[model samples]
Structures are given as structure tokens and as C-alpha cells.
Target chain A: MSAITFIDYAGVAVFAATGALAASRKQLDIVGFIFLAAVTGIGGGTFRDLILGVPVFWVANRDYVLICTVVALVVFFGAHRVESRYKLLLWLDAIGLAVFAVIGAAKGMAITGSPAVSIIMGMLTACFGGILRDLLAGEPSVLLRPEIYVTAAIIGAGIYTGCELLHLPGPVSYLSGVFAAFAVRGGA
Target chain B: MSAITFIDYAGVAVFAATGALAASRKQLDIVGFIFLAAVTGIGGGTFRDLILGVPVFWVANRDYVLICTVVALVVFFGAHRVESRYKLLLWLDAIGLAVFAVIGAAKGMAITGSPAVSIIMGMLTACFGGILRDLLAGEPSVLLRPEIYVTAAIIGAGIYTGCELLHLPGPVSYLSGVFAAFAVRGGA
Candidate 1:
């Protein structure tokens, strides 16, 4: 549970950067940047929560919004530097993808009361926000292209589900899921 | 119910024009125009159905997609003419808004078993497709502005709910709701 919380927090921050970058590409002002960041950060979780009729995760946890805001600020200040070293942000995005995928999968299981829905929910949580960001930025979402994105989420979710079948500790399953997602997302 | 059906069909057509306009604004390719039109036309209903656990309406009834596609083609060909008389599109939008509000409210009343949620659902169906289009097109969503939109939906929904309580015919309630919404939106 502790590991999940920590990783989820980190994941939100990483995803927030990717979203800000999308807005930056369009040269949006601060308000637009924040809006894009908020949408990107919360998009997947909001969709998942709404689908499950659960209270929205960010609304339940203001820290998530704060994280997004902070990340956007960092991106705003560091846009040129970040763009120069895009790899740093890309790696962070991979980590975010993996961690978020696990959180989404686990939450999906807890909320939707079905394993299949949980897995799909996990994938949606990691992928859809990025997809939405791209779509809104007037670019095709990477998910729609043949890419490692949705596949990474599915693999991560599969690992977590398998760990559950083996009666592993929740922390172990969560880490494994994150690791699985990152492994694929890192182009490995 | 029958009245709601007709209103819904009209709403779809109006939304198709709005989507077509978005494509024109972007100078999109034909495929892009169709994609944008399809997304804008059905996006809100898709969100509603996904959350409500209902079958996606257009997927179930291909006619919905057909309607939007045919309308989009018409708009694509007629965009210059439509732009020449922009007020016509705005009026069409108002009519679409009213019809969608009622259809959404009616569906919510039948599906969720809650009135407050139904009112919100009504506004979302009426307004959010346009919001999605704006967001996707990098324009400001009308929903975020100080408009009389949600207020109109609330008033119209109250009429529909009142009729539901008195066991009035659905068509009578639908027309009343539509009329109330149209007057408010147009007057505003």
C-alpha cells in the first residue's frame, strides 16, 4: 500500500510533464497549460472513476491536482531545458505509464467488481490521458498508432493479475506490475 | 419516447454540422473531417453510455453514425455556404441543444434512478459534445463561459420531471422541455 501510494504520486508528476509538453507545443498561455496539465493528469482516473461510479480520485485527493500544477510550473520554467533533454522526460513518462497502469488495474479490480473490466480500466488509465492530450493538441494519439503503449499496460496488468493468482503480497504485485509496464514501454 | 427519438435524430444532425465546422477551421483532410464529425456527433453519448453501462448507441444502431456521416458530408460540401449564413448554424445548434437536453434527461430518468443526476446528465448530453469539439480543436468551450446553458437545462429538466411525476404523456413532456430549452437558449 505504501509503495503503491508513493509510485502513484510519482506517476502523476511524470504524466503531468508529458501533458504540459503537449500544451507547450501549441504555445498555450499559463491557463491553457494548467488546463492541459489537469486534463492530462486526471483524465484517465476521472474516466475510470466515472465509469465505476466511484468518487473521482483527484477530487478525493487534492494532492493529485497539486502535483499536476507543480509539474506544469516545472515544465513552464524548464521547457527549453526539458526539450533539449527530452529523454529525461521520456523515461519519466515510461515510469509513469507503468506505475499508473498498476494503480489503475488495482483500482479497477476494487471498483468495477470484475477482473476483465479491471484490466481494461488499467490500460485506459495509462493510455487515454496521453491519447486525449495528443488528440486535443491536434495530433493523433500514440495509442491509435501501432505502438507499445496499450500493450505495455496490458502486460503490466496481466502481471499484477498473475501475482494475485499466486497469492503474492499486494506490494510485490504492484511493483511487478510497474516493472512490467516500464519494461515494455522503454522499448525493451 | 417517440418525441425524444425525433429530437435525438435532429440533435445528431446539428452536432454533425458543428463537427464539420471544426474540420473546416482546421483545414482537415476529408478523412479527418469525417473522424472529427463522428467524434463530435457521438462523443457525449459515448461518454454517457460508457458510464451508465449501456450499449454505445451508435454502435448498436448504425443509423446514428449514418446520420452524422451523411450530415457531415453535406456540411463539408456546403461549408462555404453555411459560413455565409452563420446564424443558421447557431440556431440549429440551439435546437440541437434543446432536443439533446430532453433526450439526455429522459434517458437518465429511466437509467440511473436519480433526478439530480438526470439533470446533470441532460446538460452534459446537450453541451459536452460541443465542449469536446472545442477542446479537441483547441478552442474555448462554451460550457466554461458564463453562459445560461446549465440554467436552461435545469429549467427544462424540471418540466420533464414534473410531467413524469403527473404521469403525463412522454411526448407532451418532451415538447415542453424542448420548447423551454430552446426559448432560454435562443433568448440568451
Candidate 2:
């Protein structure tokens, strides 16, 4: 698999785990856990694809759904043994957000050839999973928070899209975007 | 415009009004009203289109967005003047739900040629907007309620899809579906 694909899978796994954790907190059944996990893993990409008039990525690739289900199952059975579950969820989600933001921007740029739309796509990709999870779990959405989550996504997406528009090398642009997002979110 | 298109516009207007009313209840700004209105008006169709690998409907027709905005603006400015706002909201939403359900089922059948999937599409189209509105407003979703909302949608969608599959006349199928949905929701 390509490095980008690997990163995307890792990001999806972490997001799915977070969804499963939320299900546990809600005392939902196993079906609920799987449902939440799949939605959280795929929601952002689905929204982006719909807006860009592209076939949804997860629907086209069954492995992504399988990965999310496996990750959720693992978390469901083992999350109680972990210390600082909330902290772990936050940190892992942040990492996933940063990675997904870069990937979303790249995909948006390729599809629409518009830097403005590409940045918005990046932000949507990075944060929409958490938004869906919170909405489904009846938690306060991070979008309504005063935190730096969406801001971090915007920064990452903007940097990547801008770099691409400037004709920067792919690796350099990717690294710059990911590092910027990680720093902003971690620092916040 | 076709009769179906006219019904769609009316449904969208009603949905937008409900969303704007929700924003008013939350005492959100005009921007929040617009956002909620747009989401409520188009969320279901967007999900349906995404699943069917079709272009999002509202994006292709800017008039839908304009209608939503106008309806939201009216609601934002005039909701407090109306007596029994909650009752109005419920009735309007029920009508929108029934209309959208039939439309969604028709669209799904056209795209996938499966009555089962078409019924699911109808349910999603009828109920997803309220699901999204409640989620964003931090209110309990209608799905978690004991009401007959989704049940009514299923009946309507099922009747419509079944009639089409059985080669019934178009007008008969349409009226049967709408009348069934209206009776179920209104009776409950």
C-alpha cells in the first residue's frame, strides 16, 4: 500500500476506536458499537465525496469497513483496561485529524482543482467524524467548543492546499501540512 | 416544472421553517438559523444521493438553497409572533417528511432498481433532517423517541416502492403513499 493509504487506514482505525469508546460510555449494545464505529470512520469522507460528486471511498472499498469493525471490536473488549481513556481518545483523535486533514486537502485539490474548496474539504475530513460521533452519542460537538480543533484543521488544510497551488513537492507539502496541524492541536 | 418538483420545493420550505424555529428556540444568531435551515432542508436528499452515487441535488440546483434561505429568514423574523409554534412545527415537519419519503423512494428505485433499498432511502429522506437538527441543537433525536415517526415513513416508502414494483399507475401509488404516511403521523 502507498504511504498515504497506510496513513488513512491508521486514521480510520483510531477514529473507529474512539466511536467504540463512546458507545461503551453510553452503554450501547454491540450493534451500536459497530454502527457508531463505521459511521465515525467513514462520515467525513462520505460528506466530502458527496459534495465533490465522487463515489464514496468506503463503499467502493469493503476493507475500510472491515478495518473499522475490527478496531471497534478490539476497543470494545479492551478499553476498560486502559488508564486515562479520555486522554488517550483525545490524543489519538488529534493524530487522526491531522493526517486526515492533509489527505482530504490532497483529494479535494485533485477533484475540484480549487484551493478554496480543497481547504474546506480538508477541514471537513479532519473534524466531521468527531462531529458525527458526538451528535450520535448525545455529547456536545467540538464545533461548539472554544477549543482549537477546527482551527487546527483549517491551518493544516490551508497549508497543504496553498503549497500545492504554489507547486511545492508532494512530500514536502504533505509533511508541512501534517506538522502544522499536529503542532497547533497539541499546543492548544 | 413537474408536479414532483413542485412538491419537493414545498417540502423543502417546510423543513427549512422547522430548522429555523429550532435555531430560534436556541436563541442562535441568523447565521445559525441559515445553517440549520439549509441542513434540515437538504440533509436527507444529500445522504440518498451519496449512497446512490449521484450528484447532490441542492448543489446542482441553486434554487433549493435560495428557497431554504428565504424560508429561514421568514421564520427567524416571525416565529415569536406565531401562536403554538411547536404544533405548527410538528405538522409542517410531518408533511415534509411524507413528501420527501416518497420522492426519496422513487429516486432510489430509479437508481438501484431495488424495492428494499428504495424503502430505506425513503426512511432516510424522511427522518434524517430531524435527526440532524436535533443532534446539532443538542436535543434528543426523534429516533430515540417512542413516537410513530419512522414507522409512518416506512409505511409510506414501502407502499410507494411496492406499488411501483407491481406496475401500478403513478398517481395511484403517489396518493396512496402520501395518504398512508399522513394518516399514520397525524393519527399518532
Candidate 3:
């Protein structure tokens, strides 16, 4: 698999786990856990694909669905043993956000050839999953907060788009974007 | 415009009005009203189109967006003068749901030719706008309630799909579906 594919899978898994964690906190049933996981894992990408007029990635490849389900099940069964669930959730979310932002920006650039659009796509892809998760859980969405989440996504996407415009090496640009997003989120 | 297009526009306008009403309850700004209205009007169709691998209807045609925006603005400015907002909201929502279900079922049948899939698409198109609006406004989704909302959507969609499979005339199937949904909702 390509680097982007690998990161995408990782992002989906982490997001799915976070969704399961949220479901567990809500004391939802197994089906609810699965639904939340799937939506959180794929919602952002699905929204981006729809806006870009492309086939939804998870729909085209059932493997992504399988991965999300498996991750959700694992998290549902195992998360109780982990201490500091909130900390773990935050870190996993930060990692997922960074990876998804990079992947989304790259995809947007490939499809639209517009740096501004790519950056916006990146931000949307990184943030929308958590937004959906929060919405479904009936919690205040992070978007309503004065937090640094969206700003971090914007920074990462902007960096990636700028590097691509400068013709930077692919891996270099991607790693830089991820690092920037992570740092911003971690610092916040 | 075709019959479907006419109903689609009407569905969008009614949905937008509901969304604007929702925003009014939240005491949100005008921008929030517009955002909620647009999402409520288009969210379901967008989700259906993405799953079906088709171009999003609103994105493909800017007129839908314009209609949603105009309706939102009108509702935002006029809704306060209206007494019995709850009754009006319910009736408008019922109309939007029926029209959206028929349009969604038709589109799904035209694309997939699967009765079950068409029925599901119809229900999703009918119900998800309200779901999104509730989520955005931090209200408990109607899905979590024991209300007859989703049941009404399912009845309508199933009727539409069944009629199509029996080779019923276009308008007959459409009106029957709408009437069935409306009766179920209104009765509840």
C-alpha cells in the first residue's frame, strides 16, 4: 500500500476507537458502538468525497468498513482496562487529525489543483469526523469551543499545500504537515 | 423542470424553513441560520447521492443552494410574527419529508434498480435532514425518540418502492407515497 493508504487506514482506526470510547461512555449498546465508529471513521472522508464529486472511499472498498468495525469492537472490549481514557482519546484524535489532514489535502490538490480548496478540504476531513461523533453523542462539538483543533488542521493543510506548490518531495511535505499539526494540537 | 425537480425544490424550501426555525430557537446569528438551513435542506440528498456514487444535487445545480438560502432568510425574518410555531414546523417537516422521500426513491430506483436499496435511500433522504439539524443544534435527535417520524418515512419509501416494482404510473406512485407518509406523521 502507498504511504497515503497506510496513514489513511491508521487514521480511520484511531478515529473508530475514539468513537467506540465515546459510545462506551454513553453506555450505548454494541450496535451503537459500531454505528458511531463507522460514522466517526468515515464521515469526514465521505463529506469530502461528496463535495469533490467522487465515489465515497469506504463504500468503494469494504475493507475500510471491516477495519472500522474491528477497531470499534476492540475498543469497546478493551478500553475499560486502559487508565486515563480521556488522555488516550485526545492523543489518538490528534494523530488521526494530522494524518487525515495530510491525506485530505493531497487528495484535494490532486483533484482540484487549487491550494486554497485543498487546504479547506484538509481541514474539513480532519475535523468533521469528531464533529459527527460529538453530535451523535449529544456532546458539545469541539467546533463550538475556543480550542486549537481546527487551527491545527488549518496549519497542517496550509503547510502541505504550500509545500506541494513549492514542488517539495512528497514524503518531506507529508511528514512536515503531520508534525506541524501534531505539535499544534499537542501544545494546545 | 420535471415533477421531481419541482418537488425537490419544494422539499428544500420547507426543510430550510424548518432549519431556520431551529436556529431561531437557538438564538443563533444570521450566518448560523443560513448554515443550518442549507445543511438541513441538502444533508439527506447529499448523503444519498454520495452513497449512490452520483453528483450531489445541490453542488451540481446552484439553484438549490439559492432556494435554501432565500427560504432561510425569509423564515429568519418572518418566523417571529407567526404564532404556534411548533404546529407550523411539524406540518412543514411532514411535507418536506414526503416530497424528499419520493424524489429520493425515484433517484435510487433510476440508478440502482433495487427496490430495497431504493427504499433505504428514500428513508435516508426523508429523515436525515432533521437528524443533521438536531445534531447541529445540540438537540436530541428524533431518532432517539419513540415518535413515528422514521416509521412514517419507512412507510412512504416502502410504498414508493413497491409501487415502482408493480409498474405503477409515475404520478400515482409519487402521490400515494406522499399521502401515506403524511397520514402516518399527522396521525402521530
Choose 2 or 3, whichever is better by lDDT. Answer: 3
lDDT of 2 by residue, B1-188 (tens): 98778988988899888888887877776756776787799888888888787877875567787888899889888989989887898898889888888989999999999999999999999899988888887777888873699999999999999899889988778778888888898888
Reference-based lDDT, residue A159, model 2: 97
Model 3 C-alpha lDDT per residue in residues B28-63, reported as the tens digit of each score = 988988999999999999889878988788887999
Per-chain TM-score of chain A in candidate 2 equals: 0.96
Off by over 4 Å in 3: B1-43, B50-123, B136-138, B143-188
Q: Which stretches of model 2 miss by more than 4 angstroms? A: A1-43, A50-123, A133-138, A143-188, B165-169
Error of 1 at B12 (Å): 12
lDDT of 1 by residue, B39-144 (tens): 7788878876665557779988898899888877887787876544346656776787787778888887898666655665676677768778778777655544
lDDT of 3 at A117: 93
TM-score for candidate 1: 0.58
Q: Rank the models by lDDT, top first.
A: 3, 2, 1
Task: List model 1 lDDT by residue over A34-108, tens digit each.
Answer: 656766787888787877777667643568878888888888888876545446656766887888788888998
**Could you tell me which 10 consecutive residues in candidate 1 chain B have the lowest summed lDDT?**
B141-150
lDDT value, residue B58 of candidate 1: 90
The lDDT values for all models are 0.76, 0.85, 0.86
- Lowest summed lDDT across 10 adjacent residues in model 1 chain A is found at A81-90
Interface RMSD of 3: 4.2
Provide the lDDT at B38 for model 2: 78
Candidate 3 reaches a DockQ of: 0.18
Looking at candidate 2 chain A, the ten consecutive residues that score lowest on lDDT are: A142-151
